[model samples]
Structures are given as C-alpha cells and as structure tokens.
Target: MQTVVTAERLWDGTSLHQHPLILIEDGKIDSIATHDSAPIPARAQVHDFPGATLGPAFFDVHIHGAAGHDFMEATPQALDTIGTFLASHGTSAYLATTVTASLDATLRALDGLANEMAKLPQPGRARPLGIHLEGPFLSHEKRGVQPAEHLLAPSIATFDRLLEAAHGHVRLMTLAPELPGAVELAAHATSRGVRVSVGHSNATAAETRAAIAAGAVSATHTFNAMRPLDHREPGILGTVLTTDTLFSELICDGIHTEPEIVRLWWRAKGSERAILVTDAMAAAGMPDGEYQLGGFPVQVKDGRATARGVLAGSVLTLDRALANFVRFTGATIDQGLRLLSTNPAAMTGLAHRAGTLAPGKSANLVAIDAAGNLVGSIVGGIQAS
Candidate 1:
C-alpha cells in the first residue's frame, strides 16, 4: 500500500521543502516532492496536516523507560508499553539505557535486551535501535541515583563481558573520566564501536579533555551529575561547554536545569553540538506516584522523579523537551528539532537508522506546530495511535 503524507513544510534533517508531499511505500520513503509539483497518486491514502511542519521523528539516545515499565526489565511487554508511549510523543527510535547495577544483574539484563533487539519491530511503536550502558563505571560522589554498591572502576574485562552479553548491540557507554582506567576503557570501547560519553563524574577539566582525546564523543545529562565549574579549574562542565567537537546531552525539563542555565548551555553548545535527551524513567507518561528506575524506587510528584532526595531520572518526553527548549532558549523550531533528532543520531553513529527523512529511508517522522508541539507521529509508515 502507498501512503502520502503532506504538511505545510518539511524539514528533512537538512533543508526545508515547502508544501511537501512524501511518498511512502512498504515502510520506506519513496520520494519527497512539493504538492503542486507532484500530484498525489489516485487511490493513495493521504495524511494531511494543514498547519504543521513535518520533520524526522526524534531519536532519544538516553532514556530509561516509560509507561510504568523500566527498560532494565528487558521484557517484550515492557518494551511494547514503553515504545508505544514514546511514539505518541514524537520519538521514532531510542536507546534502552541501563543504570548502575550488580555485574550479574547487568549481564542478565543485557542478554535479555539483546534478544529483544533481534526481534522484528512492531508497527506504530518506537524502535529500540540499540543499548546504552550508563553504569558500572562511575563516581560514587556524583553517581546521582545510580547504585553506589555496584559502581566499579573502569575495567576492560568487565566491559568486555557486558558487551558480549549485549551481543555487540551496545551503541553508547557512559564513563567517569576521573577513574583510574577510564581513558583506557574509553579507547577500548571506541575500538569496539561503542560511542563513549563522559558523565556521572567529578572530573577535572584536564581529565575531561583526556577522555575526549581518548574517544569520549559526548557528555551525558550535562550539569546534573558533574563537578561544578570553577574559575580556575573549570572542571568537566566547563570542558563540555567549551569543546566544540564534543556533543553534549541536556535534559531540558527546566526542573533539572534552570531556564537561565539552559539558555547558557544553548549559547555554548550551539545548534550543531547540542542534543536533547529525556533521560526519562518508568514514570514518564504516567500519573505521579511510585515507579521503578533500575533497582531503586522513585517518587514522582508534579513531574519530578526523585529517589532518596536525589534526582533519579525524568518523566520528560522528547516532545515536551522540544517545547521547553524553545520556550527556554527561544531557538527556532528547526534548531530544537535538530537537537533531538540530528545531533543525537550523529553522536551515536546511527544517522542511517534515524534522524532524517530521505528517499530510501524508513518512514519515521512527526508533525509539529510552529510552537514545537507534537501534532502527530508516524513510524514505519504507520500513524501512531
């Protein structure tokens, strides 16, 4: 079956087309043309959004879970629930992120997640493109809600074991650069095709720079679990802001970062280097209450998710993040869309999988109003329910 999607304008992760009509066939994009130039095929199903701009669906590189199901569960049901909820909020793909846990527990969860990734993707649901290992090598002082007991110094052997369990599906790993063997681990993980992100740390600026030289390409949830910037020492936060080559993730939920800080971050990272991630937990898209984040219990009240007086994760969806970012930074909607889609995809080396709408690509995209509000989402050529 052929489907035609039309919107006021289309941003194909690069340039904009006016009055665009996209042709999707067999879950792949067949062509993109202006409505006046290319007539809609007779009998083709048309999905028209009168006042919305169409862009690539968001790619969230750091998210715990949603709809009351933690990604650490690594169950089909859990993924289905989470993925469905994510798709409705304009995310077409994500990396299932894991928190710090015991070696045995982490390995088991990795195996299960690998198995799930091997299965076929369901229609109308966001795809779990890969795994993001966010734990095991972290600083206890800045670990946030990650379990302290399970935190380990960077070890190549342990990382290899986790990678094997994941069956090479680990796309990203977060490490504390100040750890003894972190630089070596970062190099090793990069060799094995895992993009390294520096975070959950209390590292000096020099240490952060060394990690970046060793292959750390991004920073995880900047400012939340990092050393404060000092005028003399600068520290990880300063390095993350100053380094133009490094990509940085920000949880733009206003709660984690103030509007002023968000504006500052935008000014530092700019449109090319900034990536927006939810870092969302099971409480996302659910009523405020208790929810699980890895092995810990988090309380959600008025959109805040906390554990033991420390911020655990977030209940933010990417769509809301887009709106918040625009509201906070006053960036154009195109810039906000790039932060969520293009930057994350480029950071994780998954640009071919998500973050663009082009011929021969999967028909994954979203329709949004000028204010960055999600009007609709389509994944694999199926409209999100």
Candidate 2:
C-alpha cells in the first residue's frame, strides 16, 4: 500500500526546497513531489492537509528528562512518561540522557535502560534513538549541577565495562576534553558508534581542538560552563567556531545564554552548524519549583532551574526553544531546519534514519502555525492529532 500526503507547503528540511505532495510507503518516504509540479498517479492514497506546513520531526539530542522522568531513573514507566511528553511537542526521536552520579547508580540506570531497550519493539509510548551519557567523565570546575563526587577519569577499561553493560545502547557521551585520557576515551567511544560531545569543561582552545581531533563530533551546551572567549587565547568558543567539523548545541532558554548572544552565535555558526537543545529537566512542562537533576536538588525561579543557584538545567521544551530562536534571531522559516531538525540529526548520525521529509526518511513530522504552535504531528506515519 502507498500513501500520498499533500500539504499546502512542505519544507523538506533536508534542502532549501518546499514541495507539496509527499509519497510514503511502509515507514519510509517514497518520494516528494510539488503540488502543481507532478501528475498524480492512480490508486495513490491521498491525504490532504490544507493550509498546513510540513517539516521533518524535531529531534532532541541534548534532553535530560521530562514529564517528571529523569534519564538517571531509566525505568520503563519513566521512559514512557518522557516519551509521551516529547511526542506531544513534535519530537519523534530523542536520546534519553543520563546525569553524573555514583558508578553504581550510573550503571544501574544503564542496566535498566538496556532491558527496556530490548523490550521496545512496539514502543507504544515515545521513540528512543539511543542513550546520551552526559557525565561520569566531566570537569569539576564546570560541573554545574552534575554530581562531582561521581565524576571520574575517562578510562577505556571502565568505558568498556559500561558499554557492555549498556548492551551497545549508548549513543552519545559528553566528556571534558581536558580530563585525563579524554582524547583516548573520545576515540574509543566514537569507534563504538557513540557520538562524542565536549561539555562541562574549562578546556582551552588547544585542548578542545585535541578532543575534536580525537573524535568529539559535537559540543554540548556551547558557551556554558566551558572556557570563555579570550582575545589572546580564544578559548573553546574560538576553537568550536573555527572547526567546521564540530557541531554545537545551545540551551536557548533565554537564561543559559543571552538572546543577543544567541543571535551572535547564529550569525557566527549559522543554523546548519549550530543546533538548539532544550537541556531540560524534570521540571519541564511542570510548575516552577524545586526539582532534581541527577539527584541534586534544583530550584526553579522565574522559569530557570538551578542547583545551589548554579544553572542546573531548563524547563524549556523544543517548541519553546524554536519560538525563542525566532524571537531572538529574527531568523526566517528557511533557516529553521538546521536548528530544529537537520543539524542535530546530522551531528548524531541519525540523519539517515530520521530528520528531513525526503524519500526514505521516517514519516515523523510536525506542522506549526505562524505562531510557532504545533497544531499537528505525525510519528512513524501515525498522526497525533
């Protein structure tokens, strides 16, 4: 059976073209055709979405947890709660990120997710791409809300143990390049199909470059706890901007980084080079108050959550981040894909499996109005409507 989905406008997200009719079969897109640009073949099931827009489903590679579920508490029920929360906001796939904790606690969470991953054939809740391990290898100077007592050196031996325990379900790992054995650990993790990101650091430019050279493909929460920009030394920001190979993630909550700085970053890196991530926590979509990230107590004041007054995480959603991007940057719809869909997917190596509404891509997508409101959503061809 085949399905031809027609929309008033379809931003392919992969390219600069906005097509009309998108043909899909099974779970993958078969082809995309312009509204008045192609002849409709017979027997093609037509689904019309008039006065709507279509783009690739949003991907959150830097999310910690949501809906009262933290990834460090990777239980089946918790993941399901988080997944359902994400789907309502137009994210089809995500990396369930864990926080820094005790070795026993971290391994226990990983072990829990491993069992759940094996049982997620139907995934009736939300979709999980892979696990994002945020710490266990981080810098104490810029640990933010991560449990510093649990932080450790990035050792290949310990990494292998964790990876095996994870059952190869780990997809993303964040490490401070300045940490001992960090470069070696990045290379090892990359070789095992884990996307490496440099974050929670105080690394210099040279150190950041070394990490990238060793296979850190992305930077987590750029311009956060890491090194600041220096005219003489240029620090991590200089290295990240200069290195075309490294993709970066931004928190975009109006608190993590200033809106003016957001615009500056957009101009410096461009949408295709920088990605927007929520960096959200359990308090997201919930009331502003005390919450937790990696077992550390966080207080949410004025929509910004912090641990001991240090910025812990955010209560921002992907939709809110998108809205913030436009409010801050004045970016047009053409520049939307890279931040919302394309860049994150490409950086995580999930581009082929998700992101973009092109032939053979998953049917995951969202339709937002001029107000940036997600009015319609589709996950694996199933409409959430």
How good is model 2 by TM-score? 0.91
lDDT by residue for model 2 over 1-385, one digit each (tens)?
A: 6767776677777554454877767756778888778766688767676766778878899888888778888888888788778877888888878898888888898888888777743322457778889988999998887877788988999888788878889989999999889999999999989989998998889898899998899889998988888899987778887777788899888899999889878877886788989889998888877877878788887898888778888998887788788778888654664586888888888877667776766777777655555676667666654
Lowest summed-lDDT stretch of 10 residues in model 2?
119-128
Residue range with the least summed lDDT across 10 consecutive positions in model 1: 376-385
Cα lDDT computed for each candidate against the true fold: 0.94, 0.81
Candidate 1 lDDT over residue span 108-148, tens digit each: 99999999999998878998889999999999989999988
The number of clashing residue pairs in each candidate reads 0, 0
TM-score to native of every candidate shown: 0.99, 0.91
Best by TM-score: 1
